[model samples]
Target: MIGETFVLKGNDSNNLIKENVSNLKVYSIDSVRVKHFFTEKVDYIIEGNKLRRTKNSKIPNFDEHVVVYNDDGTFTFNSFPRNPPLTIPFQLYADYDFSDFDSIYGNLDKSFLSEKLKNKIAKREKIKIGVIGTSITAGAHTLEQFYHNSDKDSYPYLIKKAIEKLYRNEVVITNYSQNGSSIDYLGDVFPTALKDNNDLMFIEFGMNDHIYSWWKSNLPNFELTMSNSVDRFKTHGIDVIMVGFFQQNQSWDLEFINSTIEYNQSLSNVSKKYNCYFADVNKEFSKYSQPKINQDFCGDFMHHPTSFGHLLYYKTIIPAFLKEDVNDGFIYNLVN
Candidate 1:
């Protein structure tokens, strides 16, 4: 395999092909294809960890791009000067088989979604799923619009597809999440969020809610807002599921890490009080609390997940949608 690794200076727009190479195939993290077939010279722009593309391109803003290197200095992107730049490492590979990545175990726990709702999906009926919360739900690492169906790999998108595939149903999943959103902010956006009558609603705010400068100092307010959201959505006859947020060891300061753990506990309490399904991905990562393992699953050091991490989120809730066991695998019984 021809492999290239480089550091992308944030906010810089540059051509990746400094010299010339033959038959280049570029891919992003998680072995997601960036350029499947490239015979001509190619270039890229970066902002933070995101890759900037043309207006009509489907590529996302960041995750790390991969490419083959024939440049004089080995694998590297020829970046131009930026007003300010943040140095970020990237990797590119030719004919990568993903043999070196860690194996992902399918472990979906019991779901708390109502039986009636479960039956509807199991029968391949039509359903609408609405998701609200933060950047994670907004397709952070999945890189919305990058590929025609890249977003399908995100948790919400995967949940919809898994239900359809397992139950033979048609599912419509809507994402109303914004980057850097918190519980209180989500509450403020309630009117727009509730405009659609969703069969199932996924709430993800733990990452933002745990921010010390944001919700941690105002813990009571955070709890009240999230509680109100659960009540309001349930009142609207929508089956509510609270997404337990995901984070890694190196993602935050010790203080913020403590707050994140506390916030997840509070989410568990809220789920019990409201009798909702808590898709606790945070708890899943508790086993991987060590920095090495956390980085293995998470794409960024924080909430942005690699494809495997996203799969765990999908597992967190999709099984609950199934009426009976598929009998195809043992991951069906992973209970937390």
Candidate 2:
């Protein structure tokens, strides 16, 4: 059962989209059943809003299947039509798609960060950047094939590279992030991570905390734990940057739980109470998700951001990391 795929119904198929291939037609469908298979690609053909594949296509012959929606709300796959309805769970190793935004959203509370970490980056000093939290900070869904390179694709590494480029400094990045870990487990990992003297530390754990703790009605304990973590890091002169993120799951029983938006507000409260910086990456991504323009920001619909989504993450925090005012319409391409 560990390596099995199950149907997650009444969910958005946007995040499952492999990528937009120009030659393929687009369709819309409900429900997504996913499994991971080691195939180079997946194929499908669009008939109205339905998807089916042929035998000649390059997608592997797995017993599972995953249907994805493109950025423009269309469906695409590389293979031809395959008959016989698939009952077993399947994996889809799809292509690359970027989330697009016409404008930036959210405000970066940089007042504290400017007085603390910006100067260190500007002077090219040896700054140690520490990051802690879940798979998002650990660089999930960051495949090199889709992005330019490893350094440019990941959020932590990108922030490291961006600082070096902007400040020409000798910077070091210490990632204390563990995949699928949350704030409740922070105490377990904190002592070991605290051994290092990090100039600035980023705390990112809303996704998992919401999935686990928020659903358990443990909101008070979750906030207290987060606050304590911030206080602990601050005691070491490690400036903190709290990250609020975007999620793409439709099957998570969102109506009954405290919303990610509200969770982000709680994070903002923590940042304010602790005099730390807050980067509301979720607010920016929500611009598209709200209107249903593009939903592929979270490549896997849990926490992993695509390459473009990663840019949105770093970009929101970049202004706070710098001393001078950054242009609002700025765009970052890793290749340059």
- For candidate 1, write residues 128-153 as lDDT tens digits: 88888787777665433223434565
Candidate 2 lDDT for residue 224 = 89
Per-residue lDDT for 229 in model 1? Answer: 85
**How does model 2 fare in lDDT?**
0.56
Model 2: per-residue Cα lDDT over 1-336, one tens digit each: 011111222222223222222233222211332323322123454332223444454433432344455565434332244212232212232322234323433333446764456566556679887888887777765444223324345577777776677668877888778877877877876676677778888888877766543454766677889999989878877788888877545433332235676678888999999987788887776655431212234444444665556666877776565555444333353213
lDDT of each: 0.57, 0.56
TM-score of candidate 2 to 2 decimals: 0.64
User: Which candidate gets the maximum lDDT versus the true structure?
Assistant: 1
What TM-scores do the predictions have? Answer: 0.64, 0.64
**For model 1, what is the alpha-carbon lDDT of residue 334?**
25
Error of 1 at 328 (Å): 9.7
